[model samples]
Target: MQKKAGPFFYVFLALFVFFVMFPFLWVLLSSIKPLGELFGDKAFDWFTSHPTLKSYVSVFVNYPFLRYLWNSTVVATVTTVYTVFVAAFAAYAIARLEFKGKTVILGLVLAVSMFPQIATISPIYMFVKKFGLTNSYLGLIIPYTTFALPLSIWLLVTFFRKIPFDLEEAAKMDGATPMQTYFKIIFPLAVPGVFTTSILVFIAAWNEFLFALTINTAEKYKTVPVGIAMFQGQYTIPWGEISAATVIVTIPLVIMVLLFQRRIVSGLTSGSVKE
Candidate 1:
């Protein structure tokens, strides 16, 4: 006979799922509510009110929402692309190449990942200013890649280590150069890792608030997180508009996660599997 899940197991699972999803559901529901009805007195009034797209329209019309979205998309996409290429090569070297102090190098990479982004913000700002990169795509892109590289390299290394060296040897025997072998053989096999790293780097760059706020002073150059944060003032918070912006910024990420869910699962599982 098939075993049934224990009572407490089901209870805990339900609670966990609810805890994870409640905020997203609340935001989605709130996004569609009318401005006045959003914080109405009735407990479930927000749910019962007629929905409107005014807030969304106002966001696009009143602010440079499209500009911010475009900036974020460009930054995130470029960062993801650059990071994958650099990290994949670094990971391949660390995993497959015979090098001295590999353990020390890996440990240093981990240490860099552990360093909080805030701790280096001042230095990063100074560097950006020195290069006249502030408010430019390069400004955000450089920092995003720096912060993202460590984790991306580490994860790719883990995945690359699982791939057999015999594949590389076989490719070399067929007169394939190292670059050709990596491009033709290893890269195709490392799709799961590439997808995982790209998604993470994109999300990090997309949702980054602190650096974007500090570096990109122009409203047109600001990312979604910074744009969302500036959606209200002290005296009157436009909850409707804020909710609408939240929904707008959230949809792309949600779609990306859904589309690459299988690759994400495979990447996570790859880390656990040995050869």
Candidate 2:
């Protein structure tokens, strides 16, 4: 007979899922509730009572939300693209090429990734200001790429190492140059790793609050994280509006993860198995 999960295992799994989903469920339900229902003494009742999209409407109508969205999208897309491209080449070299001090360079890359970003923010700010990049997409994109590159390269390197070397040898035998081989052969095979890195870098850049708040002073240049944080005023916190904005910002990421769930799982499993 087939064995069933034990009671404790099922109970633990149920609790884990509930814990993971509770915050998202709360934000979603709160986003649809009216201000009165959200703030009323019987606030819990808001979940089942009249739901409305007034808060979502207010967010766009009362704020430069579209500008924030656009800035975030542009910065995130640029950062993700550049990071993935640079990291792919760097990882390919590290995985497939041999040179002196390669191990030392890889160790340094890993060490740099471990350093807290806050520690270098001041220096980064000064460098960006010197380059007159503040409040510009370049300001955010450069730093995002810098921070995301190390991890992306490392992760891609791990996956690239898992690929059989014979494929590359076969491609070279067909008169394919290294660049052509990378584009035509290796890149296609590294799709899972690339997608995994892109998702991670996009999410990191999207939710980045500290650097976005620090570097982008103009309201028009702000990202979603900074915009959402400043959505409230000194006099009051618009919980409904904040919650609505949170839901909006979160939905895209949730959808991306859901759509690429299989790829992410496969990528993670591949990394684990190879390691």
Candidate 3:
């Protein structure tokens, strides 16, 4: 029989949860604090005497924050779709196909992912400028897809390899074409991993700042991160507004994970064991 967790285990777990959640709780509390209270003597107090929605109101009214949010949604959604599509094909090929230098190719992909964006940003910017793609969705999409591809491919390859080859063989014997086999058989079985990869890719694209700031300098195309950064003025920073925006931007992602956490956990662990 498996052993039950002891009191110390529960204690440790509680501490871990506190460590993870304290920052967010502080930010949440800060977002609702009145500006005077935010800078007052009791600034570090857990709860404020005066709480107002003015910060949240300012986030929407004082700036074109809605447009910035829409821009982020567009870029992140498009980047996730194409990145997953292409990664699926590439991963399927690597996992199923017999080819020369397969290991080397995988290694190269990982190496490319490890390359710092700072090191390559200059060349990427020049390339985008040359094609007049700067300040466009395609410009950010191209780079987001590039950076996200390697991780997605790597994760999907593991899941694909976990699938039994006998399934593919059985499909072939029934006169199914390779494409049909993959679409009807392989793809459905791999949905968990695909879903997990999609969430991760979307988060990465959503939170991306350097490329978004660099490639899309046009105010209309600026994403949430850039928009939040711009909340600072000539001599003052709007801490409450920034905190409110942070809470607003983070809630959806938090809810998404909470809803799909089971699938995410299963997808991550399914490929861990050998069949």
Candidate 4:
């Protein structure tokens, strides 16, 4: 049996958690503080004497924040769903099937994933504009899916390889067709990987700022990231409102993680066996 954690472990753990959570804690504290207290002499204080939900109210009351939220949700969800659907099949093939130049293909996928978004943005923007797809959800969705796929494919490839081929052989012996085996046996067992992939892809797409700002020009098409940027006044930034919006947008992610924490942990930690 492993020994229990020592005092040093608890001290390090507390420090790690504090540093990791400090930014979010600050944002949370700032969101509830009254503007006068937040910007006034008491700004340095940690606790707020006058805590209120006014900034959160301003988030919805003063702006079309919900529409921006819907835009982000639609784009992120579409990108995640499409990327996972395509990546699952692709990864399965790479992991299980015999094929030529498989190494080269995987290398190319990794190369594509490594290419900076800045390098591709110009071409992508021009192509979208040429096709009159600018300032639309589709424009963002397509690019986001493209960028997310390479990593998703790589992740699923590792996961698919971890699954025992004996399972596949058993399914085949049971008169299960190849497609049925894949759909029924492999996919279900790959749930941990899929759940993990969806979370990463959704978070990437949801929090992406440069692409959202570059591809979507219309105010109505703007996502939460870009919409939050609009909180800047001509000369002054609305810190409280920005903090509130940050909190609002973060709730969904927090909820998703809470809901799928088990799968995420399993996905990251699985695959210890050897043939």
TM-score of 1: 0.89
lDDT by residue for model 3 (103-141), tens: 998887878878788988898899999999999989999
TM-scores for every candidate against the unseen true structure: 0.89, 0.90, 0.92, 0.91
Model 2 residue runs over 4 Å out of place are 1-3, 6-11, 46-48, 173-175, 265-274
Per-residue lDDT for 118-177 in model 1, tens only? 998999999999999999999998988667888688889988877788999999899999
- Per-residue lDDT tens digits for candidate 2, residues 1-275, read 98898999999999999999898899888888878877768578626477889999999999898899999999998999998888888899999888888788788888888888899899999999999999999999988866788878877888888789999999999999999998898989988778887887777788888899999989989998899899889999998888888888888878988898886666556545744
List the pairs of residues colliding in candidate 3.
none
Q: Model 4 compared with the native: what TM-score?
A: 0.91
List the global CA lDDT of all models. 0.84, 0.86, 0.88, 0.86
- Quote the lDDT for 62 in model 2: 93
Q: Per-residue lDDT for 246 in model 3? A: 91
At residue 92, give the lDDT of candidate 4: 92
lDDT of 2 at 51: 84
Q: Poorest 10 consecutive residues of model 4 by lDDT?
A: 266-275
Candidate 2: the clashing residue pairs are: none
Comparing 1 and 3 on lDDT, the stronger one: 3
lDDT tens digits, residues 142-220, model 4? 8886578987887788888889999999998999998999989999999878888778777888888878899897888
